[model samples]
Target chain A: MIDLLVISPILVPLLTLIVCLIPRISAKTSDAISLTSAGVLLACVSWLLITVVSHGTLTLRAGGWAPPFGIVLVADTLSALMLWISAFVAFVVLIYGVRSGPDALSPGHLHVLIHGLIHGLMLGVNGSFLTGDLFNLYVWFEVMLISSFILMVREGHHSQLPGGLTYVLLNLLASALFLSGAGLIYGKLGTLNLADMAAKLGALQDPDLVNTSGALIFVAFAAKAALFPFHFWLPASYHRAAPAISALFAGLLTKVGVYALLRLFTLVFTPANGFSTTLILYLSMATMILGVLGAVAQYHIRRLLAFHIISQIGYMTAGLALGGELALTAVIFYVLHHIAVKSTLFLVGGVLEARTGSPDIRHHGGFYQSSPLLALCFLIPAFSLGGIPPLSGFWAKLNLLQAGIETGRWLFIATALIVGILTLFSMIKIWNESFWKAPASDHPRPATNTGGRPFLAMLSLCGLTLVFSLGGAFVFRLAQRAAGELADPSGYLDAVLKGGTL
Target chain B: MNSLLLRIAARYLSWPLLVVSLWLLYRGHNLPGGGFIGGLLAASAFMLYELSGYGRPQRGFFSISPFFFMPVGLGVAVLSALPGLLGGAFMKGLWLPGFELPLLGKVHLGTPLLFDIGVYLTVIGFILLLADTLNDESS
Candidate 1:
C-alpha cells in the first residue's frame, strides 16, 4: 500500500495524459481532467511528504525488481519536498492556464497536446526527483525536453522558432554530454544506480576518471540550469515562450537542474577534493553578478524575470557550494521560495499583459491607480524575490549569508547582498514604469477588473507566495529537515537497497 | 520504376512483409526482434504499398482516423501496467501458462506481450502520421 502511494504521483498524471489523448475529448474535458490530475497529484505528494517525514524514505521498485538491477523510485525528504513544490506550482499553473492558454494552442487536436505536455512535464520532473538510477534520470530528462519542446513550438509564432531551435539544440548537446558521463561512470563502476555508485565510486582506484565524468555531468547540469557563462540560452528562449509556459518553465524547469546539482554534488560525488566546490563558488558569484546586471537592463517584463531566474539560481548554487547543514537548508528554502515567487510574478506578468496589451514596461503605466490589488499581488512576490524582510526570500538569503560568513567566502557574501539590492532595483523599475507612473495619452489606461478569473488566478498564486512568508518558521524547519536528509544520503540508499523485496 | 512492375511487386510483397513483421513481434520476448522492429517493418510495407499504388492506397480494414491509432496505442501501453497495481507494483509483468490451440501449436500470453503490441501500434501510428503530414506539406 505504501509502495502504491510512492508511485501514484507519477502514475496518475501519466494515466490522465493517455486518457486525455483519446479522440473526441474536447478541450474543456481535457482541461478538467488535467486540473483533477494536478489536484490528485498535489494530495498524493502532500501525503508522500508526511510519510517521508515520518518514515525516513520510501522506495518502490518498478516491475518489482530490486535496486542495482531494475529502476527504483526513492522518495526521500528532498525528493518529497521538491515533488510537493512542483505539484503546488502545477496546480496554480493549471488555473492560470484555463484563463490564459486556450487561444494559444492550435485548436482541436492540440488541446490534448497541452494536457499531455503538462503531464509529460510532471512525469519528467517527478521522475527525476524520485528515481534512484542515473540512466532513468536521463530518460526522464528526455521526456521533459520533448514535452517542453512541443509546448514551446505549439503556438507556431515566427519569433518562437529561433528560441525553440536554440532551446532544443543546447539541450540535446547537454543530453549527449550527460549520456557520455553516465557511460563513463558505468564503465568504471559497473553501476548506474545512484546509491550504488555513491558507495562504489569512492573505492575505485581511478579517481581522476571519476572526477572527469563528474565534471562532464556538472557541465551538462549547469547548461540546463543556465548558470553564468551557460545562461545565454535561457533569456533568449524563455521570453519567446507563451507566458503560461514561461511561468511553468520559470517555476519548475531549471529548478530541476538545480535539484540535480544538489542531489549529485552532495550524495553521489562528495566534492571533498574542492575541485567542484571552488568551481561552483567562482561560477556562482559570476552568475549572480552577471544575471542581475542583465535583469536590470531589461525593460521587457518576462525578459527581466527570466534574467532574475538566472540570478536566483546563483543563490542556490552558493548555498550548495557553502556546504553545511545550514547552507543546504538555505538551498532548499531558496528553491521553494523562488518557485512560488517566480511563478507568481510571471502570472502577474500575464495579468498585466492581458490588461495593458504589452509586455514592455515602456508601453504601459498606472496599474497601481487602476488596480491596486494586482499591484499588491505583484509587489509581494517582487519584494520577496528581492530578499526583503518578513518575506520568504529574506530568511533564505539570511541563511545563505550566515553560511557564507561561516565558510569565510566574503566575495560571494558580498555578491549575494549586492545582487539582492540590484534585484530590488529591477523590481522597482517595473513598479515605476508599469504601476506607479501615470498612463501616457498614447497608450490609454484600460479599465481594471479585479474580479475576473485572471485576477483570481493571480490572487491564488499570490496566496501561495504569502504562505512562504507567513509560514516562514514552519517552512524553514521543513527545509532544515530536508537539508539534513540531503546531507546524509544513507537513509536514501538504505530504503532503496534494503527496504524493497526483490 | 516501371509502374506495372512496382504495383505487382508491392501487391504481392505487402502480405508477406506484414506476416514477417507479426512473426517477429511474436518472437520478440525471447529473441532479438521486438515491437519496435516489427512496427517499422509493417510501416515499411504499408509505405511501399502506398508508393506503388501512386500514394492512394485505400484502407482495407482499419478505417478510423489515423490519429486514433496513436492514442489508443498509448492507452493500451499504459493500461497494460494496470495488473501490476494489483501486485503492489507498476509495470511488473504477469504471465498465463501456455495452452495448445486449434491451429497454432501453442499460445502464450502476458502483460509484457500486451505492452509490446501497444508499442507496435504506436510505432505504426507514428510513422503513418508522419508520412501523412509530410505528404500534406509537400503538395
Candidate 2:
C-alpha cells in the first residue's frame, strides 16, 4: 500500500488520460476525469511526502523485483517536494485551460496532448528522483522532452511554426548527444545503475577514464539544461507557444535537467574530478551573466521571463558547483523558490495577455487600473522573484550567497548580488510599463476579468508564495540535511548497499 | 509547380531511400547511423513526393512534421529502455538472438533495434510534417 503511493501520482493521471481518449465520453465526463485525476495525484503526493519525512527515505521497486533489475521509484525529501509542487501547479493550469474553452486548441487534440504531457513529465521527474541508475535518467529526459514538443505544437499558430521546427531540431540533436554519451558509458562499464556505477568508478584509480566519462555525462546534462550556448531555442519556442502550455514548461521541464546535474555532480562524480567543479562554476557564472543580459534586451514580457528562467537556472548550477553541504542545501531551496515564483509569474502573465491581447509590454499600459486583482497577483510574484525581504526567493538567494561566501567564491557572490539588482530592474520595468502607465495603442483590449474561480486559484497560489516566505524554516532545514547528505556521497552508496539503511 | 527531375527523383529515390533508412537503423547499435539519420532519410522520401506534386493532398500535414516525429521518436527511444529498467540494468540491450533470414545475414535483432526503427519512423514522419507546413506556406 505504501509502495502504491510512490507510483499513484503518475499512474492515476495516465489512466485517466487513457479513459478520456474514449471518443464517446461527453465533454463533461472528460473534464471530470481530468479534475479527479489531478485531485487524486495531489492527495497521493502529499501523503507520500509526509510518509517520507517520518520514514527517512521512500523506495519502491516497480513490479516487486530486485536491484539493477526492475525499475525503481525513490523519493527523497527533495523529490517528494518537487513532485507535489509540479502536480499542484499542473492542476491549477488545467483549470485555466478548461476555462479558456475547448476550442483554445484543436478541440479533442488539446486534451490528448495535455494529459500525455503531464504523465510523461511526472514520470520523468519521479524517475529522476527515484532511479539509482544513469541511463534511466536519460530515458526519462527523452520522455519529458517528447511530451513537451507535442504540447508546444498542439496549437498550430503561425508564429509557433518556425520556433516549433527549431525546438524540435535542437532537442533532437541533444537527444542524439545524450544517446552517444550513454552508449559510450554502457560500452565501457557494463552496468548503468547510479550507485553501482559510483562504487565501481570510485574503485577505479585511473584518472583519465574517470574524467572522460564524467565530462561526457556533464555535457549531456548541460545540453538538456540549456546552459548558455545551447539555450537559444528555448525563448523563441516558449514565447510562441500558447501561455498555459509554456507555463508548465517554464515550471517543470527544465528542472529535470537541473535535478540531474545536481544529483550526478553530488553523488557519482565526487572527490573532485579536478576540472569538474570549476567547470560547472565557470559555466554557471557565464550562464547567469549571459541569461540576464538577454532578458534585459527583450521587449516582450513573455520573452523576458523566458530569458530569466535560463539565468535563474544558472544560479542553481552555481550553488551545485560550489560543492559544500550549505551550497547543496541552497540549491534545493532555490529550486523550490524558483519553481513556485516562476509558475506564478507565467500564469499571471498568461492572464495579463488574456486581458491585454498582446505580450508586448510596450503595448500594455494601464492594465493595473482595469484589473487590480490581477496586478496584485503579478506584484507578489515579481517582488518575490527579485528576492524581496521575507519572500521565499530572498531566502533562496541568501543561502546561495552564504554558500558562496563560505566557499570564498567572492566573484559569484558579487555576481549573485548584481543579478539580484538586475532582476529588480526587470521587475520594475514591467510594473512601470504595464501596471502603472497608460495604454500606448488603440488595440481593442480584452476584458481584464480576474474574478471568480480564476481569481480563487490564482489567489491561492499567490498566498502560497507569500506564506512560503514566513514559514520556510522547516523546508530550509530539510534542504540543508539533503545537501549535507549529497556532499558526502558515501552515505548515498551506503544506503543502496545496505538496502537504504541511511 | 512540377518538374521532370523532381518526378524522377520521387519515383526512383523513395523506396530505395526508405530501405537505406531501415538498414541504417538495423546496424545503428554498433554502427554510426541510427534513428535520427534514418528518420531524416525517410522524411526525404516524402519530401520527394511533395516536391513531385506540390498540389498533392497528402494524408497528413501537421501530424508527420519532424515536429511530431521528433516527439514520437523521443518517446519511442525512451520507452525502449523499459525492458532494461525492468529486467536488468538501465539500457542493457535486450538481445533476441539472430536467426537465419531469407536474404540478410543472421538477423541481429534487439530492443535497441526496435527503438531505432521507431526513431526511423518518427524522424521521417516529423521531417515530412515540417516540409508539408513549409510547402503550404509557399503555395
Candidate 3:
C-alpha cells in the first residue's frame, strides 16, 4: 500500500518512542519495540524495493489532493535503494547496540534522543526520497537536521561545542538558502511541486532567473552533502560523536545530501542548467583530491575515515556529472558502495577506539598480534574501500572509471584512479598503525580489547561489507537500472501528477 | 526594573502578540501566516513575558522541557500526516461535516487545520525548548 510505503517507516519508530515514554516498560521492552520496528521497516523496504524495481515508480499523494496542491511520496528505483540502505544500516547499528555493551553516549535523555533522531531521520529520508514537491522535501530536511542537531549537541563535549556551532550555523544558512530558493521557484513557476516545476522549467523564458534558482537549490544540496567547500563540518562533528551514532551519521547523513543533489540535478534541473554539470564535475574532483589528502594527514582513525568519506562522495558525483547511461549507472553503484564501506570503516574505527581507549593511531599498535580476529575484521572493509579486486568498492570504482573512460574523460579517470589509490593509502595507514604493528611497550590493555565481543561487531559489519563487494553484480545492476530511471524523469513526473500511473 | 509604561506594554504586548500569533496560525490556511510564523510570533510574545519577569513562576520557567517538545512537535506533525493514507491518497485533507463554533461562521475544519495546529505546538515547543537549553547552559 502507498500508505505503508510513506507513513509506516516513520510511524513505526514514532510509536516506539511513545511506548518508551511510559515508565512501566524497561530497557528490554524499548529495545524490543525499537528492534522490531527496525525489523518491520526492513521487511517493508525489502518488499517495496522488489516491487518498485519490477514495476516503475510508485506515488502516494498525501491526502490524495492531486498535483500542485498535495504532497506526494513517489518511489522509483534509486529512492528505493537508498531507503533499503538506510533501513539496513539502522538495523545493523541497532543489532550492534544490543549485542555490544552499554552504549557510551551520555545518558541524559540519551535513549529518547537516539530513538527520536532515528524516527526523525527515518521520516526525513523517506520524505526526501518519496516527496514529489520541493516544499515537502524542505520539511523533511528540517526534520532530519533538527534530529542531527540534537545528536550533535547531546553529549556536550568541549570539542563538540565548536563543531556543533559550526554545524548549526552552516546548516541554518543552508536552510535559509533552501527557503529562498523555494520562494524563488514558487514565485517564478507559480508551482512548488517538483513535477510541475519540471514542465515549467523546460519552457522557461528567463534563463537567468531559472538558472539562479537551479544554482541556489544545488548549493543547498551541496552544503548538505558536504561537497568540497561545504564538507568541513563533517570530520569535526562526525569524529566527536559516540561510535554507534557516528557509524549511523557517517553512513546515512551525507548520502541523503548526495541523493538530493542526484535527484534534483538528474531529474529537475539537468535540462535548465548545463553549467551545473561542468561546475559539479570540477567541484567533485576537488572534493575527491582534498578529501583524500585530508584523510592522509589525520592520525585519529575515525577522523581520517570521515575525511575519506568526502573523497568517495566525489566518485558518486563523477558518475552523475558525466551524464550518460554508463556514468549515471556508475554514480548509483558508487553511492551504494560508499555507503557500505564508509559505515564499516567508521564502526570498525569505533571498535578500535573502544578497545584501545584512544582514537589516535600512533598511541597504539600490534592489535593484529593480540586481537588477530579484530585486526582481520578491520582489514576487509579498509582494503575494500581502497578498491582492491573482488570488493564492492572495486566494482563501484571500476564502473565509474569505465564511465569516465568511455566518455573520453582522461583527467577524471586518472583522478578517480589517484583517489582510489589514496583511499588505499589511508586505509593502510589505519591498518599499519592500529592493527598491524607490534606493541610498543608491555603495558596492559583492557579486557574488552583482548576479549572478542567488540571485534565481533566490527567483524559482522565487515562481513556485510564483503557481501556488498562480492555481490556487487546484483546491487550494481540495480543501481544501473535505477540511474537509467532517474535519467528520464518524464514517467516519474506524470505518475505523481496523476493519482494512478501514467 | 519594572516600569508603568513597561508593565503596561509587557502585559498588553504579551497577550496581544499571543493573540495575533494565534490569529496567524488559524488564518494560515488561506493567509500569509502559517504554523512557522505564528509559532515564532507566539514564542516571541512569551519570551517578552519571560524577559519582563511579570510572573515569577520558577516552576513555570522550567516547567516544560523545550528540548523534549521538539520531538513532540515532530510527533504531532507526523500524526497530522497519518490521516492522509486512509483517504483515497496521501495527505488528502480528511474532513467531517462543518461544525458551527459559537462565535465564528461555518468553520469547515479539516486535518490541514489539525496539521497546522500540530505545526504550531511543535514550533512553539521547539523554540522555547532550544531557548531553555541555551539559557541553562549560559546561567
Tell me the lDDT of model 3 at A83: 88
**Model 3 chain A weakest lDDT span, ten residues long:** A99-108
Clashing pairs in 1: none
lDDT of 1 by residue, A1-502 (tens): 7777888887888788778767778878778888899999999999999988887778888898887998988888889999999998888778777623422434666877788888989999988998899999999888888999988888788999998899899999999999998898789788889988887765664557767888889889999999988888899988777777788999999999999989988877676422357788789889999999999999999999999999999989878988989999999999999998999898888777767777888887887997798899899999999888888889889999999999898988888989999999999999999899987558764554423555566687778778888898888888998898778777666777787422
Model 3 lDDT per residue over B1-139, tens place? 4677776677568878888998899888887998899989888776677666644236653245544555566567667677766776555688778878876666777888878877887788768866667767877
Tens digits of lDDT, candidate 3, A1-502:
6566655655676665545544334455556677788888888888888878877788776666678876677788888899888888887777666533435444544564466466666767766776778898898888888878877777787888988888888999998888887898788788888888777777775667666877888788888888988999988888887777788888888899888888888766784443357788889999999999999999988899889888988888767788887888888877777777777777777777776677888867887887777677777878888989888778878888888888898989889888888889888887888877876564455656233444455666777777778777787789878877787777777777765452
What are the candidates' C-alpha RMSDs?
Answer: 2.2, 7.2, 4.0
Off by over 4 Å in 1: A99-109, A272-275, A444-451, A500-502, B54-58, B62-64, B101-106
**Which 10 consecutive residues of model 3 chain B have the lowest summed lDDT?**
B54-63
Ranked candidates, highest lDDT first: 1, 3, 2
Q: What TM-score should be assigned to candidate 3?
A: 0.87
- Tens digits of per-residue lDDT for model 2, B85-123: 555344446878779987676788777786787778667
Estimate TM-scores for all models: 0.96, 0.77, 0.87
CA lDDT scores, all candidates in order:
0.84, 0.73, 0.76
Task: Residues A155-190, candidate 2: write the lDDT tens digits.
Answer: 677788888888888878877776776676567667
